[model samples]
Target: MRTTLLFAFLLAALSGFAQDNFTITGDGDGFQEGDKIFLSYRSVKGFIEDSVTVHNKSFRFSGSVSGPVRASLYRNQNPKYANVIFDAATVYLEKGNITLHSSDTLRHSANAGTPLNTDYDELRAALRPYFDKLTTLRDPYELSDQEQKDKALVARLKSIYHNQVDLMVPVQFSFVDKHPSSYVSLVTLSELIRDSRWIDKVEGSFSKLSPELKSSVLGESIKQKIQLGKRISVGTLAKDFAQPDVNGKTIRLSDYRGKYVLLDFWASWCGPCRAENPNVLSAYNKYKSKGFTVLSVSIDEKKDKEKWLKAIKEDGMIWTQLSDLKGNDNLPYKIYGITTIPANLLISPDGVVIAKDLKREALHSTLANIFK
Candidate 1:
């Protein structure tokens, strides 16, 4: 069974939580004083992590930007949020054609975005004004310290996220989707799609991408499980799968005819599966007398056949347990989308997966109700 973590994170700047930011480090630090420093950035117009890396010294000043970028200095600043930027000798990148760079590579120079491999005195040539505005504001009494901090942090990220999303996706998508072999879109869009309103919109856009990009985009992202209130409902004929059983016996789910089957996807190593073993064992004991059968598919590693067989005997598992000892590649794990452990499908005598994620207690009652 696979252990998957659900996604959590709001759209950055568009959600209004991004700190103003910028940076400038070009071609072995060729920039000089009176040189124009230009900054234009966005927040999450593309992917959250996507951003541009600049290696140019002469940059045009936007004077005005899309998502809360600013132009500020290193030296003269307030104490509170001033820590947000870098500091240089009495020199500040505040005025027009702001000069940049210092004798000490360790010293702060001019960069609006996050700095790496540099000490203090680094100025945020980008988003300077926004940080300035933020620092100048008096702390509001209504908001608690933590609350204010949280609000400020989100605001900062939003500012960056919103400005970059558009540029990031188009350029990155164009470059990545260019090759049939490239799978950047899938990786890129995976973080964007969710089980919410955004699903349709994201899916639609994904579908419109070039054929080369489309498959890569949807590969791992599409939700296969039955979500509550989703268009895909319970009682639907489950997808058929072909997997080999123990002793090298091939098992096609469609081949199970005329008998109700419980395709239980589990592993001996999974705690949840082991914990629920007793309930399954109990169910087997009761239903085995009534013609119901279980197919315990183990995702144990290839070398652990003895361990797999031993776990079954130790747990007193009496039903038909099958495993190829190939871990995740076992039949049921792939056919049924087994990203989680201890998963089961209560198939009718005809082979339809009736229920999923059924806890032991619920499984017992459900079986009783169905059989009765």
Candidate 2:
């Protein structure tokens, strides 16, 4: 009788472990029998990838995750053109029997039978209208080069885009507020922090998350980012750092003390940075005599030093340019917690950060007001 009881308990324990596994089944009318499907997600061990060929317009992937993880599923038509992803859809990978259905492109795929996925679908549905409007407003072919150069027209378009995004922010906040324990909520908050304007609110929302969620991997990352954000936020003293210039002469941020400086962060490979160089050059030329100067810090890698020098000459950026040639690991980048290019801080002569991420008309107007 004792031996039989022990066997029963062992069987139940193994059953519970098996229940933690996940099986994902996909059904798509667009998928042919030979079509290939790819799944990618991060695990405790790091990034993991799996692939399977479609059988009878369906595919399946079985795996286990330590916790809820955001994952992507897509089809790559040609292995040689791996960069091209088709019918891609994002789904949360958790323990469950999840189903994906798409009559056409997976971009419009629907997921069900999973807690995180259900919440994600609901949130996406709620924000679809705003996203649609923003998409239409930002259609690249909607404006010609000449039309893009029209400042008034561009400003009006930008105003509309900002208004749409403003309305969408609250929906995301509501989702997080309603589902404090959901991994989807944590992911949403992480994205919200990217816009520095929302840091305060993001921090507040982060605080309200369930204790378990707060202790999650992504949660800790967001917490660190929030701390970094506050450290470099406006009204704080800008941290000083030194880097080597093209001449291999080390220069310090403190060297520019007593002068208004636009401490610019950029890289040669960044398209937006290259496009904004003309504006930076214009601001430097107009304000250099008025106690204002530009100090550009390139995040280019060691191999791209020649490209960085070429871009400077091409853009006619005559002000001081510096780089440690450490790619994204440069000291100043870590000090300021810069995650994006074409970012700049307008620092006062006294070494306080007066403003940040100033670009286009805002950059000109701020300098004009200061030098006026």
Candidate 3:
């Protein structure tokens, strides 16, 4: 009887000892000491709320988290600004300049009954592509031309990384809905927006989610950003420009005010333009008889002037050819936002831009519709 009583006492003491850590008492007394806490108390991981270590008087969570992070107690006094979002799914913890790799064991709270280990595995699997893509390329922002050639493997690996991230969005969001927690949705949605196609589709999708989920983090703030990208696009008027031509003759784009002007932008080094010359020559022949004129503008440097003139002559350019001989100072380019080589603009006689990116058949069809 004595031995049995001793054994029972030891068991009770061990149970009490195990329960003696952090005791939670927040808005909801939902967490206990052994329960793993997700650091992000905000919507979409804005700041991290670290793990709480309990002492005699109060429970304390103190450790360095990388991102905007803080702490909050369970009950009212909430001395710290740490956000404690009350949803039970999976929450991801990440630090700056560090990758939360596949091999690392992620921790979670047992009290909430969260399957965090599995959740963490999925999150890691989803995030792998982003880190992989980043490491593949030497930072292209400051790469030497020769270095780029030497690192072609980087491009291939980077493509794999980007492609993987794209693949993860739908899968990650599916996990969000399956888990049914604010924390899960917050993290999944954030991942979706990072370099996402869904960024373009956020409003339609964001509007459909739980009101708090959308409004708290992915709310009006994200809406404004999307609207900003919608400023103006192509198919707009080519802004007017005036620049000196080959013989130092000044020409304003407005000069051909009442004629069908094919304003062509090309550079001396443009191989596609050289190859397309035959088609352009044919189109010119067919249409020149019927109120058509081509104005070819070159944005070549002065050192390449001879090459420019020779290419024009060799390619049988019968159209009026002009140049500014200042590469980026091609005034028309700045006006119309010509970002690529061999861009073309078509202007009506009354100076309204009717078509852009006009290729062989499309060019013919646009003219046929306009002239007819």
Candidate 4:
């Protein structure tokens, strides 16, 4: 999922909280005099942006927030000059007198005066080195022919990148375990929901939150996600639905019971979905004779039917394609709780969900294992 979209959704989810005034004070090192610093938080009303001028290595921002919000502090200088962005800190305005302290750079920052911020500070401190290494490993450059020749070494770097991310999950889980009543745990679980495989475990941790916290925006959103998880999670039987294909022939998910089916939720306007078509085509071609097939359910609206059909033909998707032509109101997407494109469910011959959102190499690797 796109980071900004997730943050936007989270902002909407956090709308139902009591308002409280907040005051943030900070002192920094390695910043010149008169440097501007920004403090912003996401709210239902949109981004709450505020700034303070650095005087004697100290600054402050005051505002009102509906609840505990994920906030950031950054050097308000032009990116072309220098960009120093602090780790996103969960600020509990409901708790009083928040203090932010950073030295050398915003990466080495600390917070106090609230339990939530304190716990978040610890998490940031522990995760910083791994994140830094991940950033270095992910530096973009074209692969040289010599580098391409060493597939094993290339795969190792990719593995390291993924491992760094997986390693943080346990650290986050531990934080939730230690601070069951804190809203920080809710925020942590919200971030973890990107991987639906962890939904069940996250829901369990969510159950540990205080009633007040559970009723907050983050808490209610988690509940909705848990419900969504129950419906489409792996091992659950795929829901049966009949929708008309492009030719107006009714097609049903149940009809593909004896074959592995990829229930693809996408749209013609979805760039990521279009980009993934070739990979899906490759998987379909490779596995079709082994009782595998794809069932694409588009969420395109009625007016865009021509565009949808054109894309299908251009993409060479010679498979079962259907759509209700209702855009986001399409039944399959709504039922599956699909918020993003390029999402899919790999179902077994018995119609049980075997995996989900398998893309590119993961799709091929899973198909290889299944047909091996």
Q: What clash count goes with each model?
A: 46, 0, 12, 0
C-alpha positional error of residue 289 in candidate 4 after TM-score superposition, expressed in Å: 4.1
- When superposed on Cα atoms, how far off is each prediction in RMSD? 19.3, 4.9, 19.3, 8.8
Q: Model 3: per-residue lDDT, tens digit, 182-278?
A: 4445545554553323554544555556666555534455554445323213345546777776678888878877788888878768875664555
Instruction: Sort the predicted structures by lDDT, highest score first.
Output: 2, 4, 3, 1
**All candidates' lDDT scores?**
0.50, 0.85, 0.54, 0.79
Candidate 1 residue 56 C-alpha distance from true site, Å: 50
Worst 10 residues of 3 by lDDT: 96-105
How does each model score on TM-score? 0.40, 0.81, 0.40, 0.74
Task: Give the CA lDDT, 0 to 100, for residue 72 in model 1.
Answer: 33
Residue 217, model 2: Cα distance from true site in angstroms: 1.7
Higher-ranked by TM-score: 1 or 2: 2
> Model 4, range 1-372, lDDT digits (tens) per residue?
699999988887776455777788877686678878766667879967777788998877887777677786767643334544343334555447788777764546687877777877777777887788777775212357687456455455555666677888887888888888877788889888756657778888888878998898678888887787567778888889999999999998999999999999888998768867867887898899999999999999999999999999988899989998999888888888875677899999998999998875678889999999
Which of candidates 2 and 4 is the stronger one according to TM-score?
2
Best candidate (score: TM-score): 2
lDDT of 2: 0.85
Candidate 1 lDDT over 1-372, as tens digits, reads: 122222223344244543333333322243444432223223335312112223343323222222322223323233234534344222211222333444432133433222221211222322344455555544332345575456444344434443343333344334324432323334444544422223444455455556544443245344332122133225888677666666677777677666677778778787757766766777888888776778778899888887888889988888777777778776557766565677677788776767665554567788898889
Q: How far is candidate 3 from the true structure (C-alpha RMSD, Å)?
A: 19.3
lDDT preference between candidates 2 and 4, better one: 2
What C-alpha lDDT does candidate 3 achieve relative to the native structure? 0.54
> What is candidate 2's TM-score against the reference?
0.81
